[model samples]
Target: MNFANTGQMEITTLENFYRDTASLIPEGINKEIGHFNVFKIEDVLARQNKKVMPYNRRAYYKISVISGKNKAEYADKVIDIEHNALLFATPKIPYNYVPQDDDQHGFFCIFTDEFLIQSKSGVVLDDLPLFQPGGYPIFQLSAEEVDDITFIFRKMYKELSSDYAYKYDLIRNYILELIHYGQKLQPATTLYPSHTASARVSSLFIELLERQFPIESPQQKLNLRTAKDYADRLAVHVNHLNKVLKENTGKTTTDIITGRIVQEAKILLKQTDWNISEIAYSLGFEQVAHFSNFFRKQTSFAPLAFRS
Candidate 1:
């Protein structure tokens, strides 16, 4: 019920996901070639100790065909799915999947970007409209479309458990098939209005901001640190970006950017053993003192104090 903690959402790794759901990893999975797995939605739900899915970014890509009533909460929006739908989720955004009824039946497949690299599918996952930030990635499905999707998922499940040597290659083709299928249908974009240029710019700014996050290492520094930097990347004036964001989100550009940085700082402080300097540098602060000041001003707690 509390969405406030959503700001401090952590990235869910595959190991933790499997352990949390009590789902067994298939024996023949090769992590080096990139991990890929498919599961029946009911089977996964039945094995879980709790039915709740947290609001967090996954470290892998996921495509799900969900049939039933459900609610999906993203950082800036909430979508109520009343029927069968295909959902595509990328690692860049955080979302919470909440089922509203007990009659849920579907399938979901999670795979790393590496999983598709070997296939040379020529389709960059990020370039796809479905996985783009602020793009409508969920599609409402008709009964026939649902049957087509279900058939693909079932084939994936079947091939995954088989003894065939070229099964992964075949599986990759099926994944591409689903991707193409979803592309052919219209995205449920009407659910989120982007009717104006300002709205579109605001969406792009937010996407650019989100793409820099989940900093995997202390060595990975934040790229676009300021509103001006984002404006340049977006080919818009800084004033224009700020005004658009203010009109759309009721927050200035700096407010949104700093708020996100503070959120990531909090996550790093609590989740990792990284020192203050490492965390500060990663968040684009040149000095630990500056980061400390920013943290105290924003969250009213020093980084170390919050960690303790």
Candidate 2:
């Protein structure tokens, strides 16, 4: 019944994650860079004691190889896996893993952005297409691809427990390998190539908008709530930003902004028990009545009605 503190409706911190699953963090982790840990899917499930994974954002990044029937729900999308798939999760988006059957097998590793810093890998976590806000993070794998990924994960598991002085470095390479492999598996069309200034601006605008998300706590308010707000952040004139967005997405700047806000509103309404006033304030509405009017206009349903 005490689900709020259990991360059912808020951001789950790494410490809470370990506690919830009855898993132990490795002793003497290198806090200078960050933390890294890998686990067998079954090992984590066995310790879960049937506790459902919370549909909330996490404070860290995660890579998971899920085998078996499962469903993944994000704030904006849902993916159902009938057999095997690779999932990449970031702290910006909240997700819930629902296993449709009792049989589950795979591996997952949790890490922080600093774990593979630019100094080590010359790779920025956000710059990766798979981890990007608009990128496709899940991939259905072939049997051969699954075997290849499993092999790398097994190497990580072994390296993590080794006495080698540079084991962490080796693990970082393994993580990057997984990332690149996923990128290669992505459909050619899904990978956006910024060939022009307008396209680049449009892409940056979308990324900036998505980075504010999952509204993990009541006190966390949205900083960019209007077209002008985003325009200012992107150092572009409001009219220019609107023109770029309209040309690229077929929706005016305000339309796109409000559309995303409405999407988040729906997720909050259905996933959390927060009162309308709290939700309104978090979404940058000064009054619940205003939020109600906006929600009704966008969704044709009152917040309470939608929740029910």
Candidate 3:
């Protein structure tokens, strides 16, 4: 369990993201009710060895039931997954799962992004608030609701494995139905601010923050890619943008900006094989020392020490 120098594992494709990870359950063993590729795993467990990351441009999502001693962190929150309960993972965000102790049983299904997009007509996946990276995932499902979702997954799985033509089309439709159901179930507002007139400004700031950092790539050092850069792109006064973000997320514009940079730094520190200099440069720093100092100020540990 001592991964002293944990190397970065990049998942740029769907197949690349899930390879060797999912196990298919045998027939007549686990009760599968969904129409999708529902895999029921009993008494099996896994802990994320490295940072759990996935690229989901293809619009994939995951639904899982974690019974027994299993937990996962979606951002900063740790969730205890219970029996018959539902947890969702959208493609845009990255998450990590760690086992608390030992035995656990669960069923999980992965469906493509197109499955959800179809039902929305002209709408995009990004339009779905729940699919956003920082949003929460755990949903307490009623028995009837759980059964309904499971049945949809089962149907999808059956059609996926069938010999009939246009089976994929049917399967995709089922998956879309599942997400539409989820969208219906989701709360109208987020725990974070969403209704302020400045909310759009905050959202744009987030998108800009995300665009500045590509996953697992070492390009530049953490060279104080400051609020000015973001302000310029937004075509707004730095003070105005800062005021908007402060009113919304309770964080200043610079704080929000640097917070994002430091987060990517932590991911790079723990998951990638890159050295300090390369990581620094990748983060837009001119020198490794500057990145180290900034990281230490934020985290109280140097990048290397934090990874260890």
Worst 10 residues of 1 by lDDT: 1-10
Tens digit per residue, CA lDDT, model 3, 147-195: 7877776676666566666665565666557667777777766523466
Tell me the TM-score of model 2. Answer: 0.89
Worst 10 residues of 3 by lDDT: 1-10
The CA root-mean-square deviation of candidate 1, after full C-alpha superposition on the true structure, stands at 7.2
Segments of candidate 1 deviating more than 4 angstroms: 1-9, 187-210, 215-223, 231-308
Worst 10 residues of 2 by lDDT: 1-10
Q: Rank the candidates by TM-score, best first.
A: 2, 3, 1
Per-residue lDDT of candidate 1, residues 80-103 (tens digit): 999999999988776767999888
Q: How do all the candidates rank in terms of lDDT, highest first?
A: 2, 1, 3
Question: Which digits, one per residue and each the tens of the lDDT, describe model 2 over residues 128-200?
Answer: 7787764558888889989999999999999887878778878889999988888888777656575679988
TM-score of each: 0.69, 0.89, 0.76
Tell me the spans in candidate 3 whose CA falls farther than 4 Å from its real position: 1-9, 12-38, 43-60, 75-77, 101-103, 111-120, 142-144, 191-197, 220-224
Evaluate candidate 3 by giving its C-alpha RMSD to the native, one decimal: 7.0
